[model samples]
Target: MSLPVLTHCPYCSLQCGMTVAARAEDDGGGWEVEGANFPTNRGGLCEKGRSSAELLAHPDRLTTPLVRDSRREPFREATWDEALDRVATALRDTQQRYGADAAGLFGGGGMTNEKAYQAGKFVRVALRSASIDYNGRFCMSSAAAAATKAFGVDRGMPFPLADIARADTVLLVGSNPGDTMPPAMRWFAAGRERGATHLVVDPRYTASAAAADVHLQPVPGTDLALANGLLHLAIKHRLVDTAYVAERTTGWDAVRRAMRQYWPDRVERITGVPVRVMERAVRLLAESRATMILSGRGAEQHAHGSDTALAWINLALALGLPGRPYSGWATMTGQGNGQGGREHGQKADQLPGYRMLADPAARAHVAAVWGVDPDELPRPGVSAYEMLDRLGTDGGVRALMVMASNVVVSAPRADHVRERLGALDLLVVSDLFLSETAALADVVLPCTQWAEEEGTMTNVEGRVLRRRRAVEAPDGVRSDLDVLADLAGRLGRGQYFSADPQTVFDELRRASAGGKADYAGISWARIEAERGVFWPCPDEDHPGTPRMFRGAGEGAERSSTRGYFATPDGRARFHVVHHREPAETPDGEYPYRLTTGRSRAHYQSGTQTRRTKALLDAEPEPVVEIHPDLAARLGVADGADVLLRSRRGRARMRARLASTIRADTVFAPFHWAGEQTINALTNPALDPASRMPEFKVCAVDITAAPAGEDTTA
Candidate 1:
């Protein structure tokens, strides 16, 4: 028997490096996954990670291309050639009839590096449509924008998990990396379980919070205020890393003057965090021998998201966090290679290698890399919300082709966005399941799953790992890369593009070279030999960076080799914000705040997990987590049924009386659909800066489920 191939987990971003055993199938295909050693996960597997085998071969795997006659009609299968012809015919004909802006493409960072690169190429060259975007809008686009504005770079770490292991403290904000990024957790418990302080500030007491030295439960939508208050205490206590601020960064004085407005004493009203808690938070970080302030989606999903990140990053700056071994504000990007994807222009306003699509110099550089004229790259487009908002209107998009994203169940203003999408001339979703996005498609093309295909995935930590092919996709399904390439050729262009993922990947590496996040150094050959490599690999001789910028020892003036915070403000920002009620507050009619999140048994929307009988059985029915206090007030008990409604719509589900949330809020996982779905009540109000719908905060009213429903066993 052949030994297991070394591969990365297809699960979340901890990107656990695993060794998978495999055997050839009668048809010359194979399957693989961790039944062996992995640095991060050891000999363990989460339900989602281990279920990759089942998920890869599900009965429902889309093996053929399909198209519908209209929005309400059922899809009928068609030949790939016929499907590609139709898509291309529509694309080209629409381009000629409506202009480049008439058609749009939405990409996803979840795709392999090759797929992402080729997807962009397909749109920018093959389709020639000016409108293009990806799910990064919800993931980390704001962090990318804000980090680039400050440090000229934003990634999990210039260093590795070991660095966090070596640090004396890690201040986790708006993140649950311990749960989401399990490998990162190795460092979470690194501090003698006590030597270093671990602080988690989130509205919900997430899995990561269970391990923290202190869990600060601030109200939802008030992170910026808490951040500012901490910075206020840092400055007032004279913990400012003055030397590091002046030399490494640019905008400190203005920031300091601004922070002065948020003194801990004054922020209590706006943030709902007491001054005492804010003061303690300051002292903990300020006094630590080493510290790293980690930021995540919670901080970036607010209307003042950019400002909130600045506040958190600014706090790190005040404490002289950047450029140090332990101290820096690193935004935790969730998708595999999400960091690399943005660096390669997967974002709406960027070019390859962290270059700005709007900057002439950067655009020109990328144009040269792609061998296309600068004009061919098109102008910067709108954010995801704008694209969806403008669908079907004058000068708006006529078609939207989505790759691997489930928008109908996921996107904010969930109801309205779907309504607008239903009006489009064409909606094509390429995926493995009948996702909400695919459900609304005029064409749903089944694509290969990770195990059934080979490519690379960049983890949350910036580690570029190989995704060696393990199994053959079920018959009838094709790789998305092949689908797009086939479509491109049938449309009268892109004849040179190959259906081979490796060939597509080579082009991606070429396109990714020479920018701020150069990956020119990486070759499939190198990754195969080394297993993985952290990016910024600019040459063949270089070993990848494991940990990022390091700082000087305690009580030492910052040494030159440590990384520096290069904020234009020279200091971190302090945004003192007042608590504004959520977009849709519960009224006498709607009485509970509805919040959505992941279930331990599933990941985003359960697209993969639900396919696994083990996991599906584990969570067969959807239930809403209601605070016991609230449950009592509503005259409901455990296992009772409830009807939840909002201004937008409503859903019915079994009520779970639990203390998992604040008494004022309820928890619903976004995995289930139909009546049990919680998104129906969610408010789609987006963060003004990030344009992220507030998935964390919303208002809904709950009443007992009607008589026929099982309110009791």
Candidate 2:
């Protein structure tokens, strides 16, 4: 029997390094999975990661292409040739009938970096679709927007993950590393031990809150108020770094004066955080030796996400956190390669080389690369939510091709999104299973699962790694890139296409030109030679970058420091927002505020984890987490079957009483679909500025279990 090979865990952004010690397959094949820490994950995998083998080897994984003849018709198994011809024919027909803008393509961040890179190119060159966005839009768009506005370039962190350990203080707002990336918790833990204060700001009390010296439980959607409160304290206490403000930034006076309009007591009236707690948080942050203000989906998932992030940056600048040792904006991205995916120009408003579509220079560079007339490239399209709203409307956005996403579960105001998607004349899905979105597609093309393919992926903190193949793919399953290439060939765009993933990857790298996102220094060959290197490695002589900018190595300069803050008014805008209820506040009908998030045992939406027997056994059905007080009021005991009803929809599940959730709110993991899926009851109202749906907060009503229903005593 051949020995098992070591590898990394596939679930979550931490990308916890692991060794999948290979053993000879009983079926006479070689495959393996075990844990080996690869620096990022520190040699650990969550429950979902350990059971990934089940998901990879699941018997039901799609192995063949299936295409539907007409609307409402069942998909019939078809040969690969037939599938490609149909796709090509559709593309041509749609372009001829409605122009390029009529059709749209949405990319996925979960795909390997190579697949994601190629998919962006294929969409523009082969299909000529101007309306395209990625699932990453829903996760980190706010932070990305803020970073680009501040740095003139977008980077996840100016420093690296390991740098957090040296920080004297860590200010985390709307981020929970303990549950999502447990290993990342080491940074906070190390900071706490070094006499550093840990301040947690969230509406919900999380594991992160438990460890923090102070937990500022502001009301939901009040991050701006909380942030402004901090800036107010900093200025009031003379903690404002005048040197940093004068030399490194602009627009301070307007923001400072505006902040003066709202003090802690006034801000406390709007945000739920007490005035004293807000002051303490501000004092703790300002007094620390080195402080880092970290951000994540919590702050970014709102409509005002960009403003919220900018507010954080403003506070950082006012307090001199920017460009310091371990002080600056640290956004914890949720998806693997979410940062990389955006860098590759899959965004509707962007082009290759991290250039905006609207920029003449950026447009020309990309146009030159693709060998197309600038006019032939359509103007930028709307955001993902707007795309859904415009689905099947006057602009001819009637056809949608979803690659590696389950929009039905992920999109907000899911019912409206479903209606919008239903308007599509053609809905094509390329994925591993008959996903919830796949169920809506006219064509469901089976694609390769993670372990069945070889590619590269970039994690949350900007570390690039290789996705090594461990097993043979099931019967007819193919990689998403291969599917795209095949369709491109049939569509007469074969000149730019190739089946070898390495070739596709090379083209993607060439598109980057080795500058901002230089992968020119990275290659499959280099990865095989060494373990794997961080990107922006520009040349062959250069070794891969492990951590983000503190310079690379000897003679490398520290990521240029000047204490530049990333806010428009130079000062962090303290949104003195009043206490407004949630998007769908619990009315007379629904009494509980429904908060959704990940569970310790499963990944998002359960699309991958539900297939694992061990994972399923660990936590089978969906369960609602309610505070003990709320549970007592409702006469619902732990494990009691309960129904959850919201203004939009309803779901039923077992109730698990706990003190973790606030009394007014209940928690649900958004992994399940059908009856227990949290999306069924989630409100899809988006943040006005960020266009992010209110996945974090949706009010609902809960009820006791009907008699005879299973309620484990």
Candidate 3:
């Protein structure tokens, strides 16, 4: 009998380890899944991870390339040669007719490091186009920008996940791992078991908040003010670490001045949290021996997302938490490869190794690795939202290639995005399933699923994990690497592209050798042997860095002497920020604020999970969670249809009356398509610094559907 193949779950940033074995039957059957005892999940699996195998043999899984001969024609099966030739010809024609920037590429955060690297390289080197970006721009770009500004480097977590259990107190801001990443809730449970206090700050009483010792229900998009208020109270009570601040930080005076205006009373009024409750929460964190501050999409998906994250980082700096053991500030990345995707050049302004594309030295280094002239690389293009907004417009991208993303269901103002997609001269999508986005493509290339691909993924902890292939891909399905190689060959850049994952990874290591997200010394064998390896592994003899910012202070070992930070002066910067209202605020026409988020059974856009029978059965359809008080006022009963309308668009879903959410707020799961998609009503206001859209908070109005109306239609 063949042994079970060890691999990581292909969902979420947790990258929970799992084992899969092929069944011995006369027919080619599906593989069996079992939990593998790895550090991130500790042998535990969530519903998404447990049922991930079902997607491999799903009925809707794409098995052949599809092509449309004309804009008005329906899609028909085509050979790989025909599809590749058509895609290559369209991209070439678009570039020749308009400019290099006329051709665009859109990638996804769920792609492996190798695939992402290849996709980025293919766009810049083969197509010679700067119009390249990925869905991660919408996922964690604000947090990444804020972290880079404050810490000089952006890593999802500077410490290990185990540190959560050792902390004396944890302040979770705008994150609910219970509903998003179920397996991660065990760390909080362990922390609670260790007598640690957990404080949750969110507009709604989420599952994590319900389990917390103190829940501070603040207004949506007021996270910055609430954080500043906590800092104000911490200063008022003289709970700050004065010496540590003086030694380890810069720009303290600005932060102090900025936080002074956020007094307890004013903050309470703005955040909708009582002053007493704020004080208690502040005291719990300030009095603890070690405190950790963690923020997520809720705090980083607004117009002021970067500033909001900076406020939280300022609080951590004031408390002397960063660089301290078991205490720090980190963003919880939502996508499986969100950390790695940004590191390996999928972002518009980034080169491999997280290097800035604007830097000549960085450009030269990467250009040398790709065997191209430094000037040959195209300049940085617009961000994700801007790229999508420019599709088919004059002086904009005329051709677009999407891989592993369901932008139709995930993009803000999704209806408008769909219209823009329709206007594109050419649209090519690669996926294992014909998602809403893929269905609109002029050509669809069938690609291998996660279980049939071997590559590495850097998780939220900055740990690089290996995902080994456990089963054979369906006949006629190809890996993204193969597609990229074929496309590169058609574009006359065949020598630079390789169909082998290891070859791409080798080049990625060289490209990323000395940059911020260095992976020069890591290998697949090392990852398998070590379960996973933390990055910054510069040499073969050097062990991976488990915890960052260590060995820079007293009582630390001398072997790892990389200092306390990656900043020029080895000190963290503190940004001074003030709170602002969301891009869209409630008014008479739109008296309620709408928020969109994930559910436990489905991930972003439900491209893969929705095809799994068990997962579909679990979360059969989308619904709007409305507070009972507001539901009563609107005549919306439990399980009744509610018409949610915003200035952008409207969606209809069943109402789920609950007291957990704020009376003025309505929550919807963004996992469905058509009229059920909450993104249809979301605002596309972008953050100035990060260009991240405000998908978290938007103004909307909800009304009960007319009696006997078919809302689901």
Candidate 4:
């Protein structure tokens, strides 16, 4: 019998540990997977993780390069060299015809750390293009922006997941770990054992809300109001930690003045969360010495997402929650490597190591690592949605390369995005399958899957874990690294790029040496020995920092004068914020608020999960979740088809009677494509601070499907 290779799951930020071994010839020809003991998952694997191996040998697995000369033509099998040459020629032509920014690269949060780093380097160095951004902008950019402004740094969860078990109370705002990341729920279960209560604030009674001690169902896009109300009550009830706020934070007075307007009554009127429920939430938070406030995409995917997140952070700061053991304000990162993806320059405005692209020093440091002049690096590019909107337009991206993202299905206002993509001069996509976005590509390069490649990924808690190769990739398929190297060679920049994962990671360490997300101390060997390592580890002997801004060294004694924050003056900032309406509000024509989220059985865009038989069987199609009262008003029956119309586009989905949802709102999972894709109806209003689109709420109208309307579209 072959020994099992220890590795992590390929889906979500949990990155649960698992083992894979080749099945005996007599048993089967594929690999068998089993959960392995790990701190994040604690030997638990979700349904998606368990069935991930199914993708390895699935029929949809792309094993060869495909290409076409025009959008109207069908894809034809081509050699790797032919495909690389075509992409290289197109990129060069686009840049030469227009400007360097004419070619854009769209990346995914699911990519490995090495691939993410390479993608950034490839665009800035080889193509010399400033047009590069990733899908992570849609995931948690608002939380990242808000946290960086208030706390000097953003590390998803500043503390470890185990800390949740030790907390006296956990306030989850706009996060649903129960369905999004099930393995991490064990920590909550552990907290329950210790009598720690959970408070969930969401528009719907989600799976996580069902398990919580309190559920605050506020109006969509009103998370800012709800958080402000809690802080107002905390101050009104004399529960503010005055000493901590006075000593450890700055700009609180302005925030305090701002909160004055958010009295319980006004907040209740704005958010539709009863005044009593607001008071109960405040009491629970104030009474607990150890409390955690965590936000997620539901809170951050808005036109004012940064302010919404800042409000939650202000509430936590007012209550003295951050920088303490078993307590802090954090955001739940959604994608598998969303935390690392942005840190390593996949983000539009960031250089490697979370450094600002506009900073000359950051540009110089990264340029030195790449053996290039600092001036050679291009300035920051546009955000993801803006880039997509500008495709093929004059003075915009004429050619686009997509890696691991299905933008046609995932981007907000996707139907328009599809049209823009169709207008592109050249579209190149690298993936494991022909996703909805890839189906329109002019060239498609087959890349290795997670279990078939070895690399690193930063998990939800910012711990970097290793993904080991369990089996060889099928013939004719190649890793993204190899494809990038070949393309760079074709572009006459091969010497600057390496196809090996370890070499790329070592280079990443050097480039990130002194930046905010320092990984100088983390070596591949050390990661293998320690299972995983948190970031900001500065030296070889230093233990990876599991927590941040706590006087540097582990458990080091600190003086009162030294504040515990990453801000310039060592004190966390408090931004004065106010609640605002979503970009699109429910109106007489569109009388319902539409919100979108994830399905327990599927991951982003449903590219890989939809191909797996087990997951597809579990969540066969997207469904519109509506309150029974609203369904009855619309004369819609459970399991009956419903036509949902929005200003952008329309989609048809089954009407599911969910009493847990608000009557004024409807919910849909954005895991499928075609007319069933809820993103088609989502608004693309961008946050000024984070450039994140408002995917959480939009105006929509619903009615029973007209007779003979095809649900298949």
Global CA lDDT computed for model 3: 0.90
lDDT of 4 by residue, 109-135 (tens): 999999999999999999999999999
Indicate the TM-score of model 2: 0.91
Q: Report the lDDT tens digits of candidate 3 across residue range 272-374.
A: 9999998898888888898999999999999899999999999998888987779889999999998898899999999999898899999999999999999
Candidate order by decreasing TM-score? 4, 3, 1, 2
TM-score of each prediction? 0.91, 0.91, 0.98, 0.98
lDDT for 121 in candidate 3 is 93
Candidate 2: Cα lDDT at 279: 77
Candidate 2 segments exceeding 4 Å error: 25-30, 70-73, 514-516, 525-532, 535-592, 705-713
Supply candidate 1's per-residue lDDT for 510. 66
Q: Indicate the worst ten consecutive residues by lDDT in candidate 4.
A: 552-561
CA shift of 559, model 1, Å: 14
lDDT of each: 0.71, 0.73, 0.90, 0.91
- Candidate 4 clashing pairs? none
